[model samples]
Target chain A: MTRLGRSAGRRPSSGFGDAPEVVVEHAGFFSHLVTRSTGRALRMEIEARLARARGAAVAVLDLTHVVMIDYACADEIVAKIVERTGQGGARRVLALLRGVSEHTREPIQRALARRGLAACAEGTGGRGMLLGEIRDRENRAWEEVTRLGRAGTARTTEAVARRLGTGDRQATEALETLTARGLIFGDGSHYVSVAVMARADTSTASADDE
Target chain B: MSRVLSVSPELDHQAFEALVAELPDATRSGVSILFDASAVTWVSPYGLIGLLALGREVEQRTGKRPMLEPPRNREVSGYMERMEFWPAAQNVFQLPGKQARRHGDSGALIEITSIRSNEDVHAVVKKVGEGARRILQGRLGYSKASVIHFSIMLSEVCQNIVEHAGSLGWACAQTYRWQRRLGREVAVLAVMDVGIGFEQSLGARNASTGSAAALEAAVLRGESRFKDRGRGHGLQAIRRQVLEWHGSLRIRSGAAMVGDIAEWERRLAAGAGGEYAPDRVSVKTGLPPFPGAQVMIVLPAAEESITPGPEAA
Candidate 1:
């Protein structure tokens, strides 16, 4: 089984120098998430592990091996995690979902949408997409930024505005919305895809192996 | 002193009323009850679990576990034993002599089981997972995706006992060839609890006149006692899945029963003077009060047939 935490690699610092990433994979532990009790237990376990990772650590929840997830379990596990991570406070964590199959994604998406929240999902091909509630313009901005990596010439807000055919202020708000939702990383001048950051970590691990 | 109640010959949703009408009133004193099943020929999953619920209620109220006269027909007895009905009945009914243990090669997709907590719900889902897939796809000819949806429906119904019912409940599922009712193979799921029924569960938030109104609010309206947005999605999910498969979902709580009757049931119910809404959901109020709730879901066999196989186990 392709475990989520194992794919996190040992080099958490490779992608975002200061902040580390923790992967919480329950595929091996549970074959099905059917009830709220199991979901709460898994969420608590994930929170405990993420707590140790300290400031602004990104948490990836892998659902690859989970054969099924019901709505109650999805609300407790996925929705609760996203809600807690999106809370306004210092030392906040970010949530990302990986290895979500088409069968298991609906309940998770419904759970998130119920709470009026959103999270980034790492697709099978390593690209990131938003799941749950997202504004149309904000989604477009996220797509544009993920395509324009954070390296080399920094793509400023104005560049994105011109690409989107929208005003600079509108573009800025959209990018900021994406940043606030933790779908992408913003450093005042440029935005980077969380998926890209994860990919970089994988590349760094492979290079070190060689 | 003891009272004898005769079990229906064909114990199913249609005969459920007759079975309940035989019950001693809830206020009846400590009089031992003997459930005579000597003439029972067949039992649906709903009837199987409803028997346990009824027995438990009588035992709890009268402070005496009711006695059961097992069905005399060999096939019916064998079928009940294979469904693990005896083991589950031991909890609520007093039986005679040594009973047969459950065999692995039974046709029941999910056996008589308890649903008290989330762990119990998880266990039921896991136990039925593979078997449900095979039966749903191979026998009922559902798509692969429909298998998971079926599991979700199972999980949600069982979870309802834990989250909403104040007490424990029983769940059972089986796939049968309904030669008389529909002339097709249908998967039946039944769950029942002698706990706080829909009236008390939803009356706290949504005002309703009676059990029928409460059931309608919950099943048809998708209302919940909790103010939380996701609290009521389970029933909605069940309703949607049943609609997709053109299945029937019937729920009875307190003094009434409500259901989105299937086409076949609608015609049968029409013959019996059942007034239906434009959407085919029918509600009956002012029924003899029964404690807790009873749910029955029947997923009719696929219209398109490919191959015939052995029944689900």
Candidate 2:
């Protein structure tokens, strides 16, 4: 991993140091696998850049150029670094790994699920949240859908259907399916998905236990 | 006191059966069994992983941590260390270790690894992907995309252990020339776990589909134990990937074993169409009860693909 580019200034809102973003470009592929050493070296390079900036900003692991990412490398680089946040750590920088393709995304997702860690990934329309972090939350579905904004405020069956290019019935079914998974909120006729709604009434309680 | 089960040089399914046959007699003697690999010079994925599955069974029957007498042959000992077989074994059965031995890329074998967590799956997937790149893509001359499917397929297949197997499992892979059938090369991956088998695990949720039907349901229908439809895509991905490459897949669990050995001649004749024909794949039943499950995917060496993705024209 090499320092290909970087963002200079901080976001106007948060106001934590400059909050400069470090962009790492991977060269070559052990057939595009980020192995243990590769991951460690990459993490060190990113950490070195992050040390210069204060406060927590999203660390975008730009993989626009790298073709593939495998599991071991994903764990060593992404998962391990992402784990180092909360309660008196050196620094807390949100890790937003930009995927080049499914080859990268799939392994990272599986790794996150395995470690019981939730990672905020960049999604369509610039909306993203910690995928596994909110798994236990009952209303996370509605919140995620709301965050989409593209799906609209109500997230209606017809609207979802139109967006997904499927039938209204299929859209309704998909909503119901998400509701069943406790990822979304559906009231048979309508749906409401928002950040607060997705949070569990008792944050400590397991939604699935009910 | 322990009854030692001396492993053969070629430690595959045949070797496993021989070890199992000796189990009853060993148990009757009221002593623990220790696997002796001192003589084993050659090991395949099936043999390496089958050792763990067998170890789990032995522990349950006798209530003891499985033991192994280190290989006397330097090559065997070196191979075990390089593959991280010793370290993974020590973790699973709770044994002591010698120093680390680094595995090489020259061989067709991917080192045996324990899959206790998703993290383990990740490490194995990376290694398997490297194997696919080197063996399938580089040596066999398969297209870049075809090799990627092998990685994805490996990921899905190995993930089953951590997701479904209540206890630990192991995975290994190897590539070699398939002289008799395809007249080219074939990559063999063998993964096994000793836990509540498919029938006990997902059979009730799937209407007691039994062991055989459950295996088929998982692979064919992508059935998950959870009602969440998003869940069970592992086997389905494996099925589709294997089919796309005209590979052979065998899943044996509980009382039955099912295999879809894609007919090579028909595949060549069909050419681009790649239609689904029932005769091309076969599923068998009443496979003499085995604990847990074993999945084997054999991808034969083929020329570069005309179509990039897994789908047909």
Error of 1 at B231 (Å): 2.2
TM-score of each: 0.88, 0.57
With a 3 Å backbone cut-off (N, CA, C), the pairs that clash in candidate 1 are none
True contacts kept of each: 0.84, 0.03
Question: lDDT of each prediction vs. the true structure?
Answer: 0.76, 0.60
List where candidate 2 sits over 4 angstroms from the true fold: A1-210, B1-9, B17-30, B36-41, B67-78, B91-100, B103-109, B127-131, B180-182, B265-278, B303-313
Q: On residues A1-210, what C-alpha lDDT tens digit does candidate 2 reach at each position? A: 344334433433211122232122222223355344466677777667655555433456655555556554666666665554321221344455544354566667755565555555544334444454333222243343554422322345555666666676766666665544333333333343322221223123212111
In order, what DockQ does each candidate have?
Answer: 0.68, 0.06
Q: Across residues B1-313, which tens digit of lDDT does each residue of candidate 2 receive?
A: 8888898877877787677667667666667778887788777678777787777777777888778776677876676666677666765464545656564554654777777776676676666665667777777677887666676666666667766777778787777676644567777888888867777778657688678788777777767787743356567667767777767788878767777666664455356467544464456776556678888877767754322232321
Residue B196's lDDT in candidate 2: 74
